[model samples]
Target: MSELTLAIDQSTQGTKILLVRQDGTIAYKITKNHQQIINPQGWISHDLTEIAANLKFLIRKALSHAGDAAIKAVTISNQRETAAAWSRRTSAPLALAIVWQDNRTTKVTEQPNIKKREKIIKYKTGLPLSPYFTASKFNWLQTYEPAVQTALSTGDLCLGTIDSWLLYLLSEGTYKTEPSNACRTQLMNIETCEWDPELCEIFGINPKNLPTIVDSDSNFGTTTLFGTLEKPIPITSILGDSQSALLAENCLHPGEIKVTFGTGSSIMMNTGQKLLRTKNGLNTSVAWKRKGKTTYALEGNVNYSGALISWLKDRLKLINDPAETDEMAQAASKNDTTFLIPAFSGMAAPYNKPELKAALVGMTPLTGRNEIVCAALDAIIYQINDIISLMCQVFTDSKLTLHVDGGMIANQYLMQRLADIVQCKVLISPIQELSGVGTSLNGMNNQTLTLSVSKTYKPCLDKIQSQNQVKIWANNIKQLTK
Candidate 1:
């Protein structure tokens, strides 16, 4: 019988379950989107119960078509930094999962105590003292949510990212998290790969409430998915979604890079074994840890990328579907100079301004739906180009080529525009769901699996034109910030 690995990618938007064959191809795939719960106060959240139920639904739906293939292992890749708190005794969630995009803890992060320790926190965690990470969200829950408070008082609080929550659910109470997810929490020390007590104290999170840190390829435990499968299978691997995409793109060597254009964009360059801290706005994080060896990466995050398209579709009603963006952008007037800065959740990386709101500039009477759509697409490309330029400064010796994946890459116009603006070759992954594939590859221990690029986008604009475009974007950004 053939062997298969069930890989689950629980991301910001939805949960995807894939039955991956030994050769790294998906045998069966199913995805179910959960509700994006936004409170009246504008705090974004995820119903953990809904997400867990969706995962169960996808698993059962995918496995029904597995035929007689032996299900060998289960792996997970999840949205990093989304915080969750639950009961250690009852295994019930204490509160809704606070999204990484939610900035409800901004006030907490700006407190006199936390502000004074910003440098120390960044030094220890390799991340800025911002509410964008898991630590502040955990703190917010502990302080504001009544159930979380009650759980904490009774010592029943289990604080973790989405991976640990799902791991606890699937592995029957194994409270564990891997480095890729842990590093983003602003609680783990990047050097030691353990929860730093000082950093934890700074965020008012007890180290004991956190999950056990483990290697990315560790066998977390076995799960039968609450009897969804015929037998219990070992849960073998876990990684944050961006790091998983890095592994899927074969960016194992120093200076290699991958860009994941998901709900948000993460531009990560593998720094190999060395942990390099940056004075610039870029974040240094553990790419993954395996076999007692840890790999580090420099990451620049864009708070809005594909989410911009969703906004345009769902809110503005400019486009009925995300796929329509390509054709609409292509049809837009060439002379239109409208630019959009999608800082809806505030800008990240190079300019970590959570205070700035989004803007649309340089609009003319000629600007219409097509032009606005084009601008929105260009906004995503410009944000990515900003990070790519920064990475170029850090790795000056290497020529950067972005190995790209995620739903947004399907937009041909956007990919070409990214190539033109960044003035580099862009390679698109054949598989849209690389996070799941990467986790499955790690679970199977298949180092020799070849990754095939389905398409390549080369720079079409001349050097001068590309430079001018970048300058225009920079100017717009300066105006927004000013």
Candidate 2:
């Protein structure tokens, strides 16, 4: 029987299982989307029970399709900063998991107590005081949720990000998280790579409630797929989705960067071992930890990218399918002046305004569905450009390339526009599930895994035109902020 690595990617939109070959290529895959529970208060959540069940279903489904292939190992890549609380004794969720994009904690972060220590918090965590992270969500739970309060009083509360939640459920109660996920919690000290007591206290979180920090490639434990597998498989690796994409893109050296365009987006630049904190809005985080050594990174987040496309289809019903966006954008009038500021979940990174609402600006009588669809796609590119511009400033002397992988990369129009706006070559990965491939590569111990780019998009727009478009985007942002 041939050997395969079973990789599970539990993301915001869904849970996916991939049967990966030794060569870091996917052999078989299946995806199961979970419910995105949005309450009346605009708080977004996920039912942990539904996600956990979906994962088991995908595992069984993937394994049944494996035929004679023996599953040698398992790995996981999960959405970062989405916090969950559960009972350590009973293992039932205390409440719905708080999604990273949920901005309900804006009030918590703005409190006099938290605002006074914002600088100190930033110094320790290398993240700004915002509702985009896990700490404030945990604080919200502690302050308001009765179930969480009861669990904590009984010393049975287990707080963690999605990776740890999945790890704990899958691996015989292995409650641990890797650096990439841990560092985003705003509880872990980026330099020390451990949960900070001061930071935890400030967020009203107990260090004892957090997961044990482990290496990205640590032996997470063994799992039997909750009895679906004939025998247990070693769970070998765990990484945040963006960090996994970074590894999959082969961005191992300093100054190398990768952008993951998912529901939201994460633009990460590997900064080697140095924890280079930025004053210009980029957050510092642990890229990954392996062999007892830590690699640091600088990151900028966008709260809406692919989600904007989803909004077009689901909310406004502008497009029937996300795939139709490419043609719709191409059909748009070249002279159309419509622009979309996708601040639905509030602006992230560089701006850090959770209260900001989305706006569709400069629409004229000539604007129609095609123009609006085109503008929605352009919004993704513009948000990315905002981050890449800041990164260029940080690494003025270094020549940087933008290596990108995600669902949105498949849009030819989007990729080309991204290159035109960022004014750099964008290399698109051949692999669609880079996160799953990355963790699977680690599980197989394939340090020399090579990735070949399927396509490359280079700047084609005239310099003056590109500059004029960016200036217009800047003016819209300024007007919105003012």
Candidate 3:
């Protein structure tokens, strides 16, 4: 019998468990939904209990499909930088699981305490001094959380990102987190690969309470309490979703870049051994670590991409299915030059303008639903193009091909438009959920997953046109801020 690898790709919305053979090919897949909590003024949180239940369900189903064989390993690629403060005594979250998109830390993000250490954090961590990361969320609780605040005064607070929370529960509170997951917390030192006590003290986070930083391929623990899988499954690898996808892309060498067009899009390029030491909003993320070495990357983010498509369906009443983006774009008048800035919870990455609201510009009296809807779709792809260009500029001017994946790539219009706007070669892989595919690759024995050319969207626009459009895009960004 072939050995199977059970891979879990958990996001804020739900948990997706897949059954993959030892050769890195997916055999079967199952996705289970998760619950989100919206507080008084729209603070988003995940019920870990609800998430755990969903996880157990998917894990069992995936295992059942895999049958009665000892699996290779159970790997996880989690939504990066989302935090939860839970109790060790009781396997319960003390507060809400502050989503990466949640802006509850808006006031505290500008606090003098966090401000004082912003530069130092950015310099060391390669991340912006923004509230989207775990540091600001942890700090926000110190001020905003009455119960958790007092609990911290004692010794009852165990704060960790989504990966850590899930690992703790899965391991039955035995295994900790890996270095790649830990580094995203902002509390960990990239150089030392450990939680910096000084940084922790500054942010009111205790380094001791944090998870241990292990190798990328290290065995974190075994699943005891999770699901109905009778066998004790070993939990081996853990990775931030984007980093895992980067690994999956096999962009091991420096100057290689890939863009994940998920809910909040990210464009990450491998920076290799030396840190780029960026002062801009570009993040210095720990790509992955193995054998006493680390792979570093510089990332530029577009926090609203595929999510905006969902908004078009549910909120704006544009299309019942997101597949209409292709049809709608084909249906739209090409002359319609409308634009949308989907800063629903503000922008991230190169422009972490959390306070900035969404915008729809250059609308004419003749602008109908088709043009308007098409514009929103184009604008989202345009924003991604803007960020990818910024990433190339910030990281390196190398001849880079963007490896594209996620649900949005199904929209050919956006992919073609992305190729045009960015003026680069965009390669879409046959596999869509590449983040989990990457994590499972670690467990594979042979058979490298080659980059199959599904379609190569080349630069269709001339340099002059692209530059002029980018100039106007920047102007719109500035004016909207003012």
Candidate 4:
């Protein structure tokens, strides 16, 4: 019998279950999307029960195809910074999970106390004071939801990111989270890799209520998928989804980069063991911790990337399916000067203008749906280009290689545009289950895992054209901000 690993990726849009073989190849996969619960106030949330149920369904579906006997170990890569509070007694969620993109906690950062400590918070956490992290989300719950406050006061609260929630459930109440996820909570000290007491106090979070921090490759305990497995399997690996994708791309060396284009795009550059704090709005995060050693990354997050396409489909009814976007963009008139700023929730990193709203500029009589779609694609590339420029400023290493993945990579035009704007080679991996492949590889690192590239895009646009486009986009952004 062959040894196979089950990797679960719980993301904002859905839950994906992957079956990975011993040699880093994905054999089978299943994806299930849960509802995005949004209130009239525009706060985003998820039902913990629904997500947990989806995981079971996916695991059962995969086991039916691959057989339960073939699986030996389980690994996880989950959405980061989405937090929730649950009871320690019955394990029921006190409230809906506060998604990473939720802007409900925007007021939390504006408090006089929090604003005064922004510098100290950033110095320790390597993250900007924003509602997009876990700490603010947890604080929001405590202030508004009576049940959350009750649980916290009674010592029955388990407050953490989605990974910690899933870990607690999978381990039958272990209440643990790995560094990659914990670092994003804005509560962990970047250098020490431990929860900062001062940060917790500032955010009104108790250290005892948070999950115990563990290494990414540590033994997370055993599970049978709620009694689906014939015998219990060990859960050996856990990572934030973006970090897992970086690991999957095999970006272990400093200056190696990977960009995951999902609901939001996370662009990360491996900075090896040393921490390089950035003044350019890029985040310094723990890439992973293993065997008591740590590797760090400089990351820039875009709150809207692939989610823009979702908005076009669901909200604007521009297209019936996302796959049609590539064709529509290609059909757009080249002379059309339409451009879109996809700051749907808020712009993050480099341009941390959370108060600035989204804008679509340069529309004229010739503008059509296809032109708007094309502009949306261009906006995604431009947002990435902004991060690329920041990376160049911080690390002058000319050998930076970028590896790309996720659902958006299927569009060849976007890939080529990204290459042109950045003026570098963009390599796309053929691996379908990228995060799963990464976590599995990290857990089983003794084997020599090889990374193969399926496509490489080179810059075709000249310097003048690239600069002009960027200038025009910047001018439009300035107009909107004004």
All models: lDDT?
0.90, 0.90, 0.78, 0.88
Determine the C-alpha RMSD for candidate 1 after optimal superposition of all C-alphas.
1.1
Question: TM-score per candidate, in order?
Answer: 0.98, 0.98, 0.95, 0.98
Q: For each candidate, how many residue pairs have backbone atoms clashing (under 3 Å)?
A: 0, 0, 1, 0
User: What's the distance in Å from true for residue 270, model 2?
Assistant: 1.2
Candidate 4 matches the true fold with a TM-score of 0.98
Candidate 3's residue-wise lDDT over 58-98, tens digit each?
Answer: 77677677766667678888898787887766667787678
**Which 10-residue span in candidate 2 carries the lowest summed lDDT?**
440-449
The RMSD of every model to the true structure, in order and in angstroms, is: 1.1, 1.1, 1.9, 1.2
Query: lDDT tens digits, residues 86-187, model 4?
Result: 988778889999999988888998899998999999999999999889898988898999999999889999899988888788778888888899999999
> Cα RMSD for candidate 2?
1.1
Encode model 1's per-residue lDDT on 291-399: one tens digit a residue: 8899999899988788888899998999999999999999999999999988777788888988788888999999999999999989888888888788778766555
Cα lDDT of candidate 3 equals: 0.78
lDDT of 1 at 212: 98
Better of 1 and 3 by TM-score: 1
Candidate 3 error regions (>4 Å): 150-154, 225-227, 444-448
Instruction: List where candidate 2 sits over 4 angstroms from the true fold.
Output: none
